[model samples]
Target: MRKRERENPCGVCGHYHKYEEGEVCETCGHRMLATSEKASVHFSAFPSEILPQFLYLGSYDNASRSELLKTQGISRVLNTVPACQNLYKNSFTYHCLQDDKSLSFDDANQFLENCERDKARVLVHCMSGKSRSPAIVIAYLMKSKGWRLERSHQWVKERRPSIDLAEGTLVH
Candidate 1:
């Protein structure tokens, strides 16, 4: 007589059952599942040091953003466009939905005011971490840090080497 085999937990369904590759879970009948990749978002300094802070989330959709926000203590989102409906589920009290069309220093300063008043850390994102996000972040640094525009641009670039704001686009 053969002994019954113990089962592994289904990655998608969380049910413990004996399953094989391409096998459906008995409870949910999900044929496929995946283990999430655990990745850390890299930043230049400790959380408290960066003023009116900026975080780069690389490339994540709404669900990922919501999950990360819960863990990271991010209080607001400076989104280039509004997230998908119910993306935040009313979790956050503040949002600044800006366009990617040539952001200015005044715009960034306005965003800083909201963050300062609410005591919230801010995140700015575009599709990639290269151009648009860096533009806004540089502007914020100029207003908050009193750094020369060129120096501010160099600062974030040294920490996040991938930043590549286009020529003549940074707010003077």
Candidate 2:
């Protein structure tokens, strides 16, 4: 077996064990290791004022307030939470999603793309401005701007410091 496999868990021990080639586990004397460990990459938060001028990332509270939207000259909203009320339904174009982690974002992506084509200033928000909204915004950046998932995530994070992306949501 390769060195990578040997560094994994030995199945008996819950934690990974270090063993040389042809060497048994120090704790259990087992030669095998669990291959269930998945690799993940972490991104750092950067300090930059490079937010897109026409796009806004905010929370439900920000969406609920008419004055906030008006003050920012927001012309549309992409709401990613299920059953989220369109507070200014008549005033702005609204696109609502159910906010499930497994939800496909094709429609949301199309809506944001349309907004971009029309040069519409839009506010994208979910319940807490954390998982769902950020995921959608990241998707928009990927689809519309031709950005990779990691770069899109970093760009959104730079603008919205409070965004907490859901696990496995940052797909290219």
Top-scoring candidate (TM-score): 2
lDDT of 2 at 82: 60
lDDT of 2 by residue, 76-143 (tens): 88887665567677888898875455655898888888887898888887655667778888887888
Model 1: CA > 4 A from native: 1-64, 82-86, 98-100, 170-172
- In candidate 2, residue 11 scores what lDDT? 38
Per-residue CA lDDT of model 1 for 1-172, tens digit only, reads 1133234564433445554355655553334423331233333222222342444322223223565665667766655433322246487544444443555557657876677676776656543455666677777777777888889888877766756678777666
Model 1's alpha-carbon lDDT is 0.53
lDDT, each prediction = 0.53, 0.66
lDDT, candidate 1, residue 164? 66
Tell me the TM-score of each prediction against the true structure: 0.57, 0.65
Evaluated with lDDT, which candidate comes out highest? 2
Candidate 2 TM-score over all chains jointly: 0.65
